[model samples]
Target: MGNGHGLVTLLLGAILMGASSFVQGNSSKHVVCYQGTWSVYRPGLGKFGVEDIDPFLCTHLIYAFLGIEETGQLRVIDAYLDLEDNSGRGNIKSFNALKLKNPVLKTLVAVGGWNEGSKKFSVVARDPLKRAKFVDDVVRFLQRHGFDGLDLDWEYPNQRHSLENEDRSNYITFLKELKEGLEPFSFMLSAAVGSAQFSAELSYDIPAIVPYLDLINVMAYDLHGPWDEVVGINAPLYAAAGDASDSTGRMQQLNVDAIVKYWLLAGAPPEKLVVGVPFYGRTFTLTTPDGNQPGSPHIGKGIAGKYSREPGVLGYNELCELMQQEEWTQKWESAQQVPYAFRQRQWVGYEDTRSLSLKAQYVMDHHLGGIMIWSLESDDFRGTCGQQRYPLLHEINRVLFGANTPTGLTQESSDDKPSEGFRCPAGAPEGYVRDPDDCTKFYYCSGGNTHSFNCPVGLNFDLSTKSCDYSSSVKC
Candidate 1:
């Protein structure tokens, strides 16, 4: 799925005019978490869980939510919850379980997800003692399971299913207690927050939780995909003007840039923000609303695997299974750097090697924390894992960490440039202010040397190019 990207022009302008101020992050040496998802607990897999690693992609592995504590008993709750039939233990495990050793990989347990545990959390967050007990239980569970941390995925705090909602202030109090409760165990605390709209309504309360969390994983996807009357992007790199307009209604959606900026402006630390990217794509059926032709009934929804005609959402495993059985054509949208496929009258939108590459670039360009993959199991294992292709993980590690990971995609050299050259158009005015976070090379005549612009102290400037190197310690 894709969303509107109004900010592309501005991002492009920023690349062109602010080339000099472009900062190169030391992500190569930094510890970026690649939160892998284990949808449901599958027993025998042990730590390998749902996703059998083709190769290590992240520094951390995040297990999905452990359901609510109800009736004095706590149990895993989720629809399509995958559990090991014979073995009682959930599949989530340590890095060793996945057979990864190079960079340290810590497993974090997620609690209270989406519709499944919302009502239960509402009850716990209201009472301090109940909340404290929940935290204790969480710690005990982690210790028993050998997990390193906890991620809270409460869909929303105060907001309700309808316009009438509960008190929003209680969230801050709940987070404070949760933080205090987890302090003794010295565990990392994280929260999965909704996008801008829900975040605002629910009062993300980032200020109160900052001291308690190592980072916040932003659920930046779901901006668009099959839910709307017409086609739209699942996620956009930049906000576009025509998005949500008649001409672009078929393409309206959300962008990563705006979401990140919004979070930062809302007080989220950029370094402490792990951007979420979906490994799967969304799908929609198309029929000319103006014309009489009837579109497929499943117009705005997920297509199964890469087959456009197929119906419904296919998790990573489902998609992988489909890939093994079919041959599908691929197309890449330059504006979004995302891939999609079309067959007959059906359309499927998903990520490809090229789109993923751009996504990595976006994370680095913005000096944002690391990238987060929804689920590692969805990748083309044979294509991305074996000695030959090393598909998704290979490209991710190579681009983000500069690790010598092997991949089939062309590794961007230190000298790659955008096809249109970095210069602004001839007739463009000179005073345009450019963003310093563009990955492409660019030019600007806005003012005094763009390269020489003053940077916040503690940031290092390389004399060779006058660009800032923000890999290690740099004041924002």
Candidate 2:
């Protein structure tokens, strides 16, 4: 979803995100990891599986994209890989089993990503019986599979893929009904939303639906890439002055700052907002080596990563391997608080550990809920960069949580865990307020007095539900 454009490679499937690594945080912030299930097929180093994942790196892990048919019934995108029935691999159970490693983790199944399109969802939402049946079927599927919730990666409602605009209202009805149905099971609901102002405006009535979601994960990357005329920051923190002069004329608002601001202005509460970050780079082949700046013209397709082998994209690990060599020169774009590198003809823009740290602070500064990663396997899980594995994610967690976050990504020890001591706020309302430093702790208020408490070991505080619940079942 981050690569909203029709990049030949990123357009392949349900725009997905994932998490893996050994580090766990009591972070009150959300670490949503989306995994592209097909990465398991990546020839060698790129091949990843649920067992390769670390349960603690993310608070919630999403299995992207189960499919939905025209009739509103759900289907597995890859039964041979996802189910165990009929001698299948049973990835559904393997993905959910990450919770056994970190019981507080939330596992969710996503339906209808970019490739899945909007027609089937629109058709279902428009029909009362179909919508109800779909919701019922989804809940049963989740229960049978032991998932904590469902993520709607519907791409959009009322988008061009759909024939009618009634999708906007119908989506609200669907959410309302889905909420009522899931409430009995305490299953949290989330949606992967587009970040562009034009698409978001067309796709959702943000205010009307915010009340129904636990987290609103904005696919905030892909602001610029090979789809555009120049070498632009893939997820620029701020639009540069020269960007406005671009041929497409989208430069002014095609940035992370503007996208998040638009969502806030559109009535999405700060706490429910989880900004998306890419662990990969938008790569392109430069038309001229000398013109290597952000606006440099490009040939529109860069060399594929040795691992991902996707023409227009490179995983962070692939980019890092290139940067490790003396020939590749990396530069920092201070104007955008981002990083990009050029190795002769190939120019790529992507987020690094430093940029992600800045983004972590950005999330807290804006009082936004947390950060969402595009996929689990793209990060340097193999430690090929000669650093600890999953450095980008670990950096974000350290900054978002506290200075003393666990350093071990593979093993947990009682020694590194710190205790929270957040003071109760004065003149607070009579309810529960989760600790900003600890996902497991909450401060309860009654008659202007407060007492701090912790969620059961396997759960986290759900601000939306006003109680402690499973990570997948709670809204941050």
Candidate 3:
């Protein structure tokens, strides 16, 4: 329903931190950030490159999902991007290059994602020779690419994708082999495990694998989404009253509290359990106009966003942009501790600064290792929604490390900075200025510099608060 992210983060595991602090691997707490490299393909505001990352925010940066061959070899999903060309633009090198700016950051590459599926991985895991080659390939691939570790993002091992984990016991056995191969290089080994009990029981012998894993990233979000017949929050902190206890405890198991408890009781140590915090929201097209609340029926996924261009999900940047509109009404659900907004039939349940900060506090209270953001790319890196660029991430950072700052948080990248490439015109000294070259763009001049922006499609650039409008509404 979403871009690969709909199930991807859940597939890899989940969201936040704004303002970079030196949250290193050995630090008292963990802040794991997964970068969906696919974001590079997104145009305009949605484009997020490694250079866009705030190096100081996370201790661990996992470059999401390198592909795996059926015969048990690592494959670069985008060799054109990951590998260095004659032109020397390699995403892998640039991704790992962030460590130069932040020496404390531990960069890792993940293999397997929702799209990669389980069949290839499951088959490889069951074959000893194939598994050994896979382990060796992972080690060599990481070392060659200069990654500090490998994140085993198998989605769920035993779930019948109809491919992965058919043998059931192959996952633990595969991990044993992977551990041996990785240990020699001192590479950190982590896994993105399922959250709810149903998947947990089906996928893991957690105790057996915990011994080999340095971090067990709980894919704690995505408990419910468009797939469900009824509406639900993307990542509810606590079970809502409406989430009445069912005979199977499906509702109870869907929240963060229950998911964490299940993992702890199942034998994961508090330090090893890194909780997932989702950065994006799941959207739905309500079956009825008034059916905006959670548990309501839906016709299908909500309309795709202006950016991200995915039907069933909206990136935080897209969500915030919608919130700026007059028709969209955002409301908080006290029970779930997350927010949902709707304009007509479109509804989405998503996280905010308050929810993320509370989740950080929850991690501390529960004695969990740290909070892992589903991604760094989805946050409002453009600072389009006011506040700092990554308001949600910043709230968690401020709460977790007391990283206090006013005005600009740090020397942010001008790659997507507001009015980055434009300049103030002589006639218009400040405020919104028309682009000299193109009518489809404008600049917001402030603080003696031009803060430029592109006018939304089919709209003429104008000097108004609305930013852009149809040709008939205003004079260009």
Candidate 4:
């Protein structure tokens, strides 16, 4: 009787565990992070390779920039870098190998980017035979490389440098064909789409394209850049008061809220819309430092980033370093729910944990599918900036998957006191604790208790500093 009772208890426990897992899986938000293949060649930026990714952090990891050949065949941008056996270091094998860590993590190949150009896509998508061949080729390529699916990033369907007018309708047809082809294999189909009103209207028939797609990853960033005549936020959550102007055309509807609303209003299902969050910032050289607000005069691009090596752009890692400079001042725009930095003649618009937190909340409140990050390599994966490794991704996970926090880690409260009956074992390493009242002020963990410290206003804690300091002063 005792043995029978024990067996019954074990069976009940196992059933409960399985049910808990099911509930967790159903509630978790889909985090799709793009991994740029070209980032492997950027030397100064920690030379990020596929091996650097933390597969457990994201639900889907999309390998970016698989070019479309003129003949409508899918081709890797660099065969040598992607496929060559670098003693188990090759991009393709290394990326797929991430499944060893998290078997459920999905990997997809992203075809086309800003530089890949849309000519090939437009040419092939316009012809039925070519489109069929392209669809088959994409499936074969993904299967051959062990990819879970494909992400089409054609920039725009019917815009400058691409086929005009018919391209938009043809795009829907192409997606339908691609979905039909991949249906047998149960593969996922997603697309990276433009968020600007003009581009969205010209590029996609939202209602028609919806049935064929698993998710619509909106490119919410780049709404404003150096190309614009006036400065603007990189990815504003909301539009500011009196910010409306038909003169700038689509620029007026550049915020995330407007983009999401447009798609929803245009018949996109809430669960299929994945809002994008940029892991980088747009930079501008201020024409006059006195008036640093958006639309301030700017003559040229801001100082080029050392690692990104791009004028008017800076990755989160670079931005974190730049914030260390005493001259740089970080300011938040309540209306936009985004932050910007300025120093001397330079100004930058970018997202941080606070802004990203709000965005995540917005996603949850609106019943959206999930969040998509432009490029994972731009993130401070190495924990050099101090908050935590993959801080942006971590915050998203906390907000979206708080019920199942990874590794059994629980979020610490702002109360500055350890939880009841909690005690750290002896010999734990000292670390920085976040202050709830102020993000710039952090507490140091020593002797199992936290001691509070404040960083100068506009400056944040640097892990290297062991104290609050200017962004430029930290050697991240």
Candidate 5:
């Protein structure tokens, strides 16, 4: 669990890189977002579609939940919506067509999700021929669908309905084979990894797996939910001191910083690891209304929203609406950099502009590749809350990309303009701008414009101080 060695090495690398002028050169940081195919079915949620996505906001957009067939071949979970030519409304076609708007956007198909389970992946990974066929079928499927690559979201590799022990090493072999097969076609291969320490340690051979991956998206959210007997934050950036409901000591590690550090210590490259952020919140109903802090007693799932319609869950859009109610009060957890809202006996743990800004800053300070949002449909894309559409995502862009304008908007309205001669650029390739005052501090350039962000506390912008030092060493 110790990250001392990795932390030192990472900082050393950053220092060496800082000595070179190339460190200031433009190098794009990925903004990868997952779009749930099922969201289109939720009519109450405005039936979000691929067209609602702003291709400019994401460098890579993953269309999620492709399943594994019983025959071990990759299957489109929704055949009608994915391949129906008559309607010309296929999700695949519509999603890929976004390239016409922004050629730089790369579309990927994410196979498997929490609901799909791991049985198929276990069967395919254990059998060499089956694995080959699965890889071959997926490559062809992606090609036919005009997708840029494949993202293997097995949910997990060696736990919960999977071959727990052997699946760990077998996963590495399977990825190697898949990568080799995809190399001929130049398809990108990535995986969605579990964040819990036990599962993460047992499920991945980090060193071996990193070599075959173009990106490794850590599912840092869902650390706590209704599944837990006690109420907790959905995706805390750090563990608060009072949480002790879980005896396994795992509760302390259920946060973004711990999860990312675990991967780094396990040999995953920082640049290849993209931290995942949830666009939704985990809701819970309080058993005792007076005591509503995290780890307090909770009876069951919170009431479902009119749009999300699922108990114990609310999308960012729904949460925004809930915020408008006078009864709901919001509180920020500074240690975790997350927020929770309570109204009467209902509570929901979610992220907002303030917390997300801190998360984005973490990504930059830690020298991680970038941020990945769980699903796009959960965001308020219609500007309904008196804010610009996709406000949460826009905050991410503002911090990570220096984008002054909202994702889909070409320019801010004259009334909202920052200054007379400063029109924000529509979009620009991701890169870094040097800070004149400090080499350890820099501005991340995304949609175009520079937003100042600093390195972890005590760390400077100089090449030597680009990566984070040990927490004990830094004031942060």
Candidate 6:
């Protein structure tokens, strides 16, 4: 997902951009929180709350994204019977524990992440009946879990891996049907999007899909991965030019902020977009200048970490334990406000309380909806990291939502300031245009004259038509 060779270049680019805190304009004010499920599948991990970690960590989260498997034998496809019941009946105890603690927490089951969800989604979305069955099954699953909504993390639509074409039209049809079927429950629908520029461009017709969804979870992390060579960049705010920051001394690539802006400009409403934060760090073994230099080059395997690995990625759980054991020292990068560490010839990049605190600030400053973590169980409940307190959820609430409690998360009163400096265009309504000079950037001509312009971007704009084309893109 990212490159080691591009790390240095992106890092330098970020530095040049200056580490200023983001400030939100009037349009970006929605926030949704998320938590993934893989850690729950492991043995002996359920009593996360009772085990020392803050049982109430998820209490203030506006929405928690749970993962589910689409199991099958005969594909009976009842709108209610399609979801695998593991996180449902089997995991009720844990979920109920969370719900009882925080009544306002909205839990949405996310179906199909990176590797495990494509097959079933492809099958169900292609056929009307199967799609119906899936929608019905999803509804049933929600009712069974007492869930507040559903998030379609279909990894991709009309494409395999990273390539997609005409089949994309079929993808929207599937969403339209799902949206129609789930309307009765007022179910919240959202989709997890890729952070890579190419992936975002061709993956989904977001503007077309906006009508069918409540939010779009922009998976803003994983810009870099183990597969890349030369001390790779995990994530960057700007794409690197050449070989500026790595083992090859070549420019690193991928600009996360650009991805965010792309979606914003493409019609995805800022309020409906949730930014993703990884609960783990991609790991790589690097050759050192002298075994003491943390910025060494790779020598071995590039893998994900759990607890501890000299040459692999480290999941949040392991990272928390390390913080507690004092096994590694945490360092913060002013550039991205993310944290990284070096221990036993290994370099680990991850998020921490301070770093997360800063990110929360960024979210509020930029008016982003809220933060979304990969999985819920990765935080350290046992205080394994000492007094610094990796109160991930708490930090989010404190900084972005301005809430001391669950109710406060969504109930804050806005200042309602009138943007008096800007004026509406000659023919536009008072609030429709922010500034006379910026009208063309935000609005365009349509049916006749007065009411024809659009409100810019959302989850439903058509790329090819330069308008809202849900089915496909048309260059004309």
Index of the highest-lDDT prediction: 2
Runs with alpha carbons beyond 4 Å of true place in candidate 5: 1-27, 86-88, 244-247, 404-476
Off by over 4 Å in 3: 1-26, 86-88, 163-167, 404-476
Q: Model 2 scores what on Cα lDDT?
A: 0.77
Candidate 6 lDDT: 0.50
Model 3 accuracy (lDDT, Cα): 0.75
Q: What lDDT tens digits, residue by residue, belong to model 1 across residues 32-91?
A: 333334422323212233444532345566766567764323466532332444553435
**Residue-level lDDT tens digits of model 4 in 1-476:** 12222233233323322322322433446789999877877876457888778776777899987888767888777878888554444678788766433433677889999988878888988888888888989878776677778899998788767358688899999999999987776678999999877779988889999999998998888888888887787999998654775566565588999989998999999998899999999999988888798778898789777777899998998889767655588899888989998998889999899999999889999999899998888888777877777888888877876633332112231223443433344564545444443445555344465433344334455454344445455443
Cα error, candidate 1, residue 202 (Å): 3.3
lDDT (Cα, 0-100) at 63 in candidate 2: 95
Candidate 2 — worst ten consecutive residues by lDDT sum?
A: 13-22
The parts of candidate 2 lying over 4 Å away from their true place are 1-26, 244-249, 403-410, 414-476
TM-score of each: 0.66, 0.80, 0.79, 0.79, 0.79, 0.66
What are the per-residue Cα lDDT tens digits for candidate 3 across 252-368? 889999899999999999999999988899999999989888888997788676767889888888888877864787889899888888888889999988888889889978878
Task: State the lDDT of candidate 2 residue by residue for 359-436, as single tens digits.
Answer: 888998898999999988899988888998788878877877652222122234211222354555677654457778
Per-candidate local distance difference test:
0.52, 0.77, 0.75, 0.75, 0.74, 0.50
- Order of the predicted models by lDDT, top scorer first: 2, 3, 4, 5, 1, 6
Clash pairs for candidate 4: 323-471, 324-470, 324-471, 324-472, 325-471, 325-472
Per-residue lDDT tens digits for candidate 6, residues 262-336, read 777888777776777766676666576244222346775554444333356666667666556766655655555
Q: What TM-score does candidate 1 reach?
A: 0.66
lDDT of 4 at 323: 73
What local lDDT score does residue 114 receive in model 3, on the 0 to 100 scale?
A: 88
